[model samples]
Target: MAQPDVPWPLLRSVEALADAPLAQIADRLRQATLPYMGSSALVIFTEDCTGRPQKKAGEEEIISRVSITELDSLRATIPDEAPWFGHAEIAGRSRAVLALKYAPSHALLVLTDPQPLESTPTPGLEMVRYLWRIAARRIQEKVADAPPSYLLESRAASAERLRVTAELTDLHSTTLETLLAALRSPSLDDAAARSTVTDLAAKALVALRTLSDRTTDLVEEPVATAFERLREDLKPLTRFGGVEVEFIEPPLNGRALPGEVAHAARAIVRGLVLTMMEEPEVSRIRTQWDCDGENLLINIRDNGSGTLSADAPSIVRLDRRVQALTGHLQLEVMPGWGADVFVTLPLDPPTRPAGDVAEWNLAARELEVLQHLVAGRRNRTIAMTLGISENTVKFHVRNLFKKLDVNSRTEVVALAHSHGIR
Candidate 1:
C-alpha cells in the first residue's frame, strides 16, 4: 500500500535553509513562507550581522527603498508585543504588514501585503511565525559561523553605511529645521493647520535622527562587552564539543572596538579553535584577549600534534581577515608540543595615505572640501554633503586655497582637478 505523500515541499525548504549561504537566506526564507502566507515582500532586519542588517526579498522597489525610519517606527509599536498586523509606511508608501520580533535577538521580520494561503488565516499565521523564529535564530547562528571573507566584507560595508547615514541625518536635519522655521512664522496663514503639520514634521525629524544614532551604535561595541558576547557565542561549543576550553578576559577599560573588528576577532579565534579541535590529539584549548590602548591582542593555544598548517585554507582565510584590518597574525608550531597562535588587531583603522592631491599637504577635511569644489558644489552643498555647517565648509575651502596657493574658488577647483584630486 502507498503511504501518505510526504510533504516534499516543506522538507525541501528546510533542507535548503540548512546549508543556505548568508546572501541567500532571505530569499530562501521567503520561498519557505510563501506556501503558508502570501506576501508581496519579506524583510528581515537583524542587528546580529552589523554589516548588512537588512536581509530582504520581494518587490524590488519596496525592498530597495525601505528606510530604517519605517522599520524603527514599526518596531516601536510592538515594544512588549509582536505579530502585529496592520497598514504601515513601508518603502515610502503604506502597505499591509505582518510584523514579528524574535525576543531572543530582537530581530524583526516583516511581511508586506500579507494574506492567508492555507484557506484559514490562523493556521497560516502560526506557520509563518514558526518559520520566522527558525530564520531569526539562523540569522545569528550564521553570523557566529560566518567565514572570514564575509566578516571582512561586512566590516567594510558597515563602516561605509554608517558614515553615509550620519551625513544623511545631518543634511536632512538642516532641511527640516528650515521647514519648521517657515511653518512657525506668524506671517503664514492658517496657524492651526500649520501647527499640526509642523508637529508631525518635528516628530519625523526626531525619528530620523534617532535612526541615525541607532546606526552609529551598531558600528561599534565596547571591548569588554564584545568579549563577553564572544564567550556567549562559544558557550555552546564548549558545552557540547567535549573539549576543555578556557577564556582569559580582557580588561574592562579596554577601548571600544569597531563592530566589524569585534566580530572578526571573535570569528578568527573561533575558527582557530575549531581547526585545532579537528586534530584527534587535541584535548584542550585556551584563548585570551588583551588591549594595549592601540591594539587588541589575541592568543589561542591548543594541545595537539602541532600539525596545523599555516597554508591551510582555513588558516589563510583567518590571516586574511587579520590583514584586512591592518593586523598581524603569527603561528608557532612544535611537532612534539602544540600550536600557539598570536594575533594583533589594531584598535584604530590604518591611517590612509594621502592621495595625489596630498602634495600640497592638505588635511583630510580640506581635501574633502576640495573634492566637492572640483565637482562645482557650493559651500552649502558641500556642507550638506559633509554634514558640516556652511561656515565650516568655508573654513575648509579657505584652508584649501591657501594650501594649494590659489586665490579664487575657480582657481582652487582648477588646481585640484589638474592634480587629479577627484
Candidate 2:
C-alpha cells in the first residue's frame, strides 16, 4: 500500500517558525505531529551536553516516566537486522514503535496506535518514517534560518558606526589645529590669515557635507546650504577686529546642518570675537582657510597683543566642548601684542538630529543629560559628573523620558547613540 502524502502547507509553516525560541519551536512541532499519529502524548528529544537524550517537549508526567537511560538500553537490544517497526509493551499497554534516522546524527521514535500495526503494517511504518524525516528537516532548517537578535546585532552595529564617526570627527579637529597654528604665527599678515579663513571655510563645508552624507540619513535640509552663510557670518568678526579676511576658494552652498551644530559654531565664533574685543590697540587680524583631503585648515592671526592664556576659564570651557566631540581647540596669548583662538569641529555634528518638536524636543538641560546617558554612565555617576544631586538627575531623567518619548535607559542610549550625541 502507498503511504499518505505530507501537507505542503505544513512545510510552509516551518518558514514562519524560524527565529522562534527553541521551546516554542519544539512545542509547535509536537502539536503538528500529534494529530497524524493519533497519539495522546508526544515527546521530542535532543542530545544534551552529557550525551543524554534530553526531552525537549511533551507532557511533564509522560516525560518524567520516560527515561533516556532505558531508551538507550532498548536501542542496544535491537539488532542491526531487526525491522524498523516493532511491538513494544510499556507500562502494560502494547503500542507500535517506529524508528528512523532522519539526519546523520539524529534519530526519531514514534509511538502510535496498536490496531493499525497488526493490519496493513508496512504503509503505516513508512508514513511514520516519512513524517519524522520531514519534521526533523523542518526543525533544522528553521534553526539555521533564525534572524539575529535585535539587541545584540543593533548594539554591535551602532558601536562600529560610532568608531567610523570618530575618525571623521578627527578630520575636523585637524582642520582646527592647522587654523590655530596659522593664527599663532607671528609672520602671517592680515592678508594671509584672511585667505586662509576663506579657504578653510570652503573646504570645511565640503568635508561637512561628505561626512553628513556618509554618516547620517536624517540630516536637515538647510545644512547643505549654510556653508556660505557661515563664511558670511564670520566675515564681520575679521572686519571689525581689524583682521583682513581672504577667500582663496569662496564658501560654497552645502547642505543644511543640524541646527545645534550650526548654532554651536556660531556661538564659538561669537565667543572668539567677544574675546578679541576685550583687548584694545590690536591693529590687524587675518583669517584664512583651506582643505587638504583629510582636513579643513583654518588660520586666523592678529597683530594685536597675543595676550590670551590657554588656561583661562573660557578657553577651558571651549576645550571641554571640543574634546567631548573629539575635536580640538587651541589658544595663544602673547602679552602686549595679540591673542589667537583656534577651534576645530567635526564635519558631522556631534549629535544626531533630534527631529522636529514632535519627535524629540529636548530642553537645554535635558540635552546635557542625554549626552551623559549615551556614555553608558549610571544615574548616580551622571549626577556626579554633572555636579547635580541624584534627585535632580532623576528629575531630569524623567523629563528627558517625556521629551524624547522613551521609557527606558537602554532605549535612550540607543536613540542618543544613533543621533551621535555621545
Candidate 3:
C-alpha cells in the first residue's frame, strides 16, 4: 500500500522526529497515529527482535489507546498477510489493524477504528504504512551518520562542568592572595582580623558570582570575558584605596596567554602600587590598555609621590619581568607629583639566527644599537646618531653580541640581515 501520495509533510514536521534517534524513533511512530488516524486517540506498536510488539505512543482514552501489555497479549491474534491490513474483534468491538514491514529490523502496527468500520476505502491506513517507511529510513540514516542526540548532549554537559571547575580554581587563587595580604596587616586584633576575613569572604563571593554569570552554559569562554569578570571583582579594592580605576577599552576578546604572563603582570602592577603610594595619600589610579597593531600597551598611572628612586627594588624587579618578555617598560616619575608607567609588549619576538644572536637578551638601548648596526653603520656612526659616546656604542655592541651568542661583527650583521632586523 506504499504510495507517492503519502503524508510526507506530517511525518517531517514532527519537531524532534525528522532525524529520529533510534531510541526515540518508536515513540515517533506512536505519535504519528494521532494525525494518521484523524482521531483524538490512536495506538502504535513496533515489533522487537523477539516477535513481541511494544506499544510506543498513544492518547490516554481508555477505549481508544491500548497499552503495550495489551498489545503484547493481542500479538498472537494478529494474522500474517502480504500487506497486512484487516479488521478484528477486540473487547467486543471491531478494530482495524494495519501492519507494514518498515525495515528488515522492524515493523509498524497501527490499531484504530475500535467501534466499527465505515464501508468506504480509508487511504489513511495506506498513508500510515508509507510514513513509517520514511521514518524508519531517517532513523537508520541518523544512526549511521552520528552518535545519538542524547550522547552529544551528555558530552556537552560534561565539558561545561569542567569549565566551571577551572573557574572555581581561579577564584580560589584570588581568594588566597587576598587572605595572605590581609594576614600581613600590622593592626592584628581579633575583631579587626575577623572583619578582614569577612571582607575577603565577601570579595570571594562577588568574584564567584561574577564568574558564574559570565560562564553559564559556556563550554569555552573568551579571555576577555574572564578579565572583565576579574575587573568587576576587584572594584571593592578601588574604593578602599580611594582609587578610581577604569578599563579604557573593552576587555581583550582573544586567546589567553600563558598563565605566567598574567601572573607576572599582576605582580608588577601590585608592586608599583605599593612602592609609589602610602596607605592614605593616594587619590586615584587609572589603568588603560590598548593594542597598536603589533604590540599591546598597558599604562598604569597614579596620583602619588611621583619621585621614584633609581635603585627601587620593586621597580627593578618589574623592569626585569617586562624585559624578559621582550617588552619595554617606561617609568615616568616626577618627584612631588604623580607617576606614569607604560609597558609595550610585541605580539611576537623576532627569530634569532643559529648560534649567533642567540645569547643576546637585548636591552631596549642595545636593541636600538643593533637596529643601527643592522643598517650597516659603524660604532662611531651609531654613537653620533644616538647622541652617545663611541665608547658607549662599543659597550652596547659588546653586550648585544654576548646576548645574541655571536662571535664577530660580521656574524651579527649576517644574522640581522637574515632576520630582516634592519
Model-by-model lDDT, in order?
Answer: 0.80, 0.51, 0.54
Model 2 stretches with alpha carbons more than 4 Å out:
1-227, 234-260, 291-297, 333-337, 348-400, 403-422
lDDT of 3: 0.54
Give me the overall lDDT of model 1: 0.80
lDDT for each residue of candidate 1 in 297-365, tens digit (9 for 90 to 100): 999999888888899889998898788777999999989678999999986654343346546787888
Model 3 pairs whose backbones collide: 357-404, 358-404, 359-403, 359-404, 359-405, 360-403, 360-404
RMSD of 2: 30.0
Residue pairs clashing, model 1: none
Question: What local lDDT does model 3 show for residue 299?
Answer: 83
Give the candidates in order of TM-score, highest first. Answer: 1, 2, 3
Which runs in model 3 stand beyond 4 Å of their true positions?
A: 1-223, 229-236, 251-260, 355-422
Q: Name the best candidate (by TM-score).
A: 1
Better of 1 and 2 by TM-score: 1
Better model by lDDT, 2 or 3? 3
- Tens-digit lDDT track for model 2 on 30-132? 5544444445344444321111123234544444465443444345555542235565543234556543444432444544332233343335444445555
My TM-score estimates for the predictions, one after another, are: 0.66, 0.31, 0.30
* lDDT, residue 148, model 2: 27
